[model samples]
Target chain A: MGSGSGVSCAVTLNTSLTPEQRALYQDVGQINHLLDSARTIALVGLSSDRQKASFFVAGYLKDEGYRIVPVNPKADIILGEKVYPDVASIPFPVDIVDIFRPAQEIDGIVDQAIARKEKGIDSPAIWMQLRLVNLAAAERSLAAGLTTIVDKCVKMEHGRYRGGLHFAGMNTEIISARKRKR
Target chain B: MTHRPGPRKFGFETRMVHAGHVPDAHTGSRAVPIHLTTSYVFDSPEYAAQLFELKQYGNIYTRISNPTTAVLEERLASLEGATGALVVSSGMAAQFVALMTLLSPGDEVVASSHLYGGTVTQLKQTLLKLSIKVTLVDPHNDAAWEQAITKKTRALYGETIGNPRGSVLDLEKLSRLANVHKIPLIVDNTFATPYLCRPIEWGATIVLHSATKFIGGHGSAIAGVILDSGNFDFSRFPAIAAPSPSYHNLRFFDTFGHYGFLMKARAETVRDVGACVSPMNSFLILQGLETLSLRMDRHVGNAQQIARYLEQHEQVAWVSYAGLPSHADHALAQKYLPKGPGAVFSFGLKGEGAEVREDGKKFIESLQLFSHLANVGDVRSLVIHPASTTHQQLTEEELAACGVGPEMIRLSIGLENVEDLLWDLDQAFHALSRSIRA
Candidate 1:
């Protein structure tokens, strides 16, 4: 309901932010670039039910031309993709690891992402879901030279990037600051 | 615009005005606009489908969510420190939805015997028709409460300041029992409001309100809200925690997490029952909430003075106001409602038999300031002969048990000058005496 809050209020907590790191996440254009370049997204803790936010966001990302890799112990498959138990279990390289888990679970997921990178897997950027934050996880990911995003949704970021949210009457903080690139 | 975020961490008074609200980006309206449309237009077919599927949180139909009502819901939840809330058609509807959300046909509810008569009827009769058994225990008896629960019990329910009786709930003892049993403790704080007491702070899992009362201070609207503390695990509750066939095996707790109960109540219960509050009533309730603290303060002050005045009067036999030192519940009220014992109270007239009823009616009719009606918590003073009006259907034993005596006259103290209220009652007692002589 806020101008800049967009679809998610995206309150970044737990993960300590330096002035520079805070600026990076707040910069809408930089976020837009990240979404544009991503090819595949791994949604950890994704559920099979359509009502779940993770399931919805994964479907949206797949529709937007990004391959969705479902990662959850409960599901055998989701969004027509084979489900993996964790980040390290994914058969192919994941460009982005978007976490849909709670704040408490983010640290473990981040740790797995770090391990995957250390074991010569692709260094996928980490994106934490809305309202979920872990400062230690963000710090560890950033220390390993990975692009870390916290307390934001990948679907909403893409929606804002394409100027597709205004038609839905969502608070598109996009048009004003970006000078109507659409 | 580049300031530190999370202004939401502000104080209650500030949040009451600003929470769940923002200037409309399109219209720049500072006030939350009442979205009168019954349905919202989706950006795409996929978007509409997603909303219907509960894949995302967005307004699809007014019955499920409206921007205006959503703001009121958020503001109330914020004021009560609840994780989420749902606003419905009336105070009764709010109670129904919240209870119905947790209850199934075979489940049970353990409730306090001292409660609003309508609520008593709701639990005893209506819930029975649904096959949901309710066990009522004397609120003062700790052992009775302990014995009422069975494996089938789904929730524990009571009122903060009971109707007619004005007895204060033992929140600590009640919370302890609820915790031991692992069932959610629910309190209807319609009388106390959050200004006086927050049931959540005392470990209540759910706090409900008949927004028609103090929440809407003015008698212009009928509304109710159910606020969840998000503390209940709901892990064992199949309706909330397990897969549902209604929405493709979707579990509300798995999806919404912390505010799972509220989300399920709004989406499933409200959608099926069709008891959502209109955007118009939602707007009016929000208006009342803005000055709630101010109105409640005056209401409490007037009530304390009026209760004391009636206590010393020769015509008055006894008063049932928790704020009074003579009240049986005064100690409990002091602990839970230290701000004051609220505005509504009952007092018995002197003399006995059928003549007491006549005198009670005459006293209420003779009053110029107090409006004689069934409603309470009005900005203007209201009077009711509960044994004859609100409790008319109840037998003598039932009425007496609820503290509605034959000589009882209920008064809802308002914001009128205390002198005028007392003077009005003073003259009414004279009228009762004059009628007796006639």
Candidate 2:
């Protein structure tokens, strides 16, 4: 699962000593690298709610230099970006199609991604937020030469990679350990 | 406390009432009295050794097991169609022990993306720290599950019906995938009590219940149970079968035979981690389980009636309950839960109009009968504005990923008279109308 680049190779070795560990590290590392490289992410279901993870994570990623496109039917604008009703109507090349819909609706999203590719839009990477993976669609994206990251949180990943621990405002290590102790 | 004739074998409901209890043998009291005592007296060193060495299954300490709690465990195990059960302090503890026994650091768990918010947090945040990676996939799409599994994958997890949104999972497909991969399928059957849908019959290897919900039939208890079907072959999972530095070189599969996973979880995970359910809570949950079948029947009926009522309401924008034919997963629900979809659901208000606040918080505040709270699985209807509450911690993008909108109100339907419930909703809607007009 390691990328051809030496950076992933080094991180893979340093973090994961076992073969299984190496695969997981490499898979997540490659996805993060892709996220870092991509300039624009079209977030399907990006809400206008300030308290939402989508709102905060998009805000954070926008600060990190990626353009955030809010694709919600309800909002006129989110994070200063005009909200598009769907991916098909976004009217721009989308580098990544980050979905916030349920797993059951992912097949439709994959179809939209493929349609975008057919229309000469760059076959964007497909990233499902935590607890939001569509395996069939993920495979279709993979077959179409698009990258896929599923069942992982974009906010948590940003925190993991950008050295921003405690993004959720709770100390993970101490809290979980104390929880285990109790 | 010597094994004691295995608590008078009886039918499931009867045992639920009386098992692990014997009229307080000393006190001659009929009820299964709560033994709040933390420590127990040892008959002798030889007897203690026999208990520790698995020579006998008796109460050595409260942390391991208790008489009052054992009845709940036995009853739940019987009801869930499993050989044995472990009652933990909380639903999270049950999940933690189940995963810890099945997975080691660096192993993987393939789970549905549709899960409770706490579980999603646990898998993505807490479990990630332990180096046990989780792969989220659409459990409805069997291929996605198959693709997510690598050699390192250990288990598959899903809720019978998703929390908040009430999307039904394709348990049969997930179970088949787990079998093909030689991994156990663990179904969190909290939303659908055993009376509604039993995952064991559908190929789930283990079942977990947040007894705080329907199992308790009341909101008083916060406990969880893990039921081992004793179906999945642990010999297939070498990591679990092999000796560990954690325990005194005791291979769980070799020592516990069919109940290896449950035994290891009790001895290693529960003993070391110490998340034992209180005897009092166990007693409370047992009382609830007695009326589980009856309560769930009413819960399903009330939820169906309310979902229909909400669907027809003028003020509601969208209703996402599987019982509603318009729900995207309605067909899947028909397949997995033919009887009826469980009680929880989500609906969005008409927040786009100029009269309504763009955030949709007003509609939630307008609800009268629905208590606004962070918890779910209550006998009384519950409501929350996700953008403001349950998922407030999530980013805007994350909230969308979870299908939660600022204007969305998640409702956990309770077992109230449908007519009265609707009257309350009518008044709430009328209030919203007044507020909008004003």
**Best prediction by lDDT:** 1
Error of 2 at B340 (Å): 1.9
CA lDDT, every prediction? Answer: 0.80, 0.72
- Stretches of candidate 1 off by over 4 Å are A1-41, A47-53, A60-96, A100-109, A115-182, B1-8
Error of 2 at A113 (Å): 72
- Residue-level lDDT of model 2, residues A1-182, one tens digit each, is 11122222122111212444334322655765776688889888887765344665676667556888888878898878888888888788888888888889888887898888987977787887655656677778778777776655565455434423221111111101011110
Query: Candidate 2 on B314-388: residue-level lDDT in tens?
Result: 888889999889998899888877878888888878765333434356656666778888777788988876666
Chain B TM-score, candidates in order: 0.97, 0.92
> What would you estimate as the lDDT of candidate 1?
0.80
lDDT by residue (tens digit), candidate 1, B1-438 = 697653123566776676666555466667768889899888788777767776545678888888888778877877887766888999899999999889889999999877888888898889999999998887898888989899999999999998887889999889989999889999999989998999988989999999998889889999999988877778777779988777777788866565578778887899999998889999999999988888999999999999999999998899999999999889999999998989998899998879898888788889999998889898999999887778777666667667777788888998999999999999999998899889
What's model 1's interface RMSD, roughly to a tenth of an angstrom? 7.6
Give the share of true interchain contacts found in each model: 0.07, 0.00
DockQ of 2: 0.01
Q: Could you give the interface RMSD of each candidate, to one decimal?
A: 7.6, 23.1
